[model samples]
Target: MHPAALAGATLGRLAHHAVSGLVGAALLRGASKAAPKAKPATRKAVVGGLAGGIVAARWLGSAAEEARLKAGDMLAEARSSLGEEAPPPSAVDIGGHDHDHEH
Candidate 1:
């Protein structure tokens, strides 16, 4: 897709992985107290956490992608609406400023 989509996807995946790793590690450690071995419940918690994190991240990424696309479209529309002549930037003279201009 577009660069926005790619960037969103990449960032989302990274964030998802980081969060999932932290959560998973915490869960595993917490569960270790009850059962040192990897049990069904522990597995469930890890898998569930990972799945949830990924899904949420993907949704956020999609939303960001949509927003980017909308912003781009709006900018294009604004440019077209402005026609050939675009607005000029607002600036100050700054010629008589207090700064030392001698050199």
Candidate 2:
């Protein structure tokens, strides 16, 4: 791989790791503070719920993505039926913001 690509990959991995670690640490700290004397069963149940939630999120994300893709297809077909084509990339307004702002 090119040095630039390697550096980019390394930076991406480091950023991901740093963010995940910070989030996980914050979650644990909050939970500990909220339940300093949690029962073993309660802890086990919380962990199980978190694990199931993570698994469910993956499937949910896939379903949401599939739905969005189908919606896009339908939209494209509808526009084509109406003898319309999408605006060019440069003509599309994103966030309704003008690009010619002066500092």
Evaluated with TM-score, which candidate comes out highest? 1
Q: At residue 50, what lDDT does model 2 achieve?
A: 100
Per-residue lDDT tens digits for candidate 1, residues 1-103, read 9999999999999999999999999997887777856577778999999999999999999999999878767776788787843333334255766786785
lDDT by residue (tens digit), candidate 2, 1-103? 9999999999999999999999999998988886856767788998999999999999999999999878877887888899999554467466766689785
lDDT for position 2 in model 1? 100
TM-score of each: 0.47, 0.45
Clashing pairs in 2: none
lDDT, candidate 2, residue 11? 100
Residue 64 displacement (Å), model 1 = 1.0
Instruction: Judge candidate 1 at residue 91 and give its lDDT.
Output: 45
Q: How many backbone clashes does every candidate have?
A: 0, 0
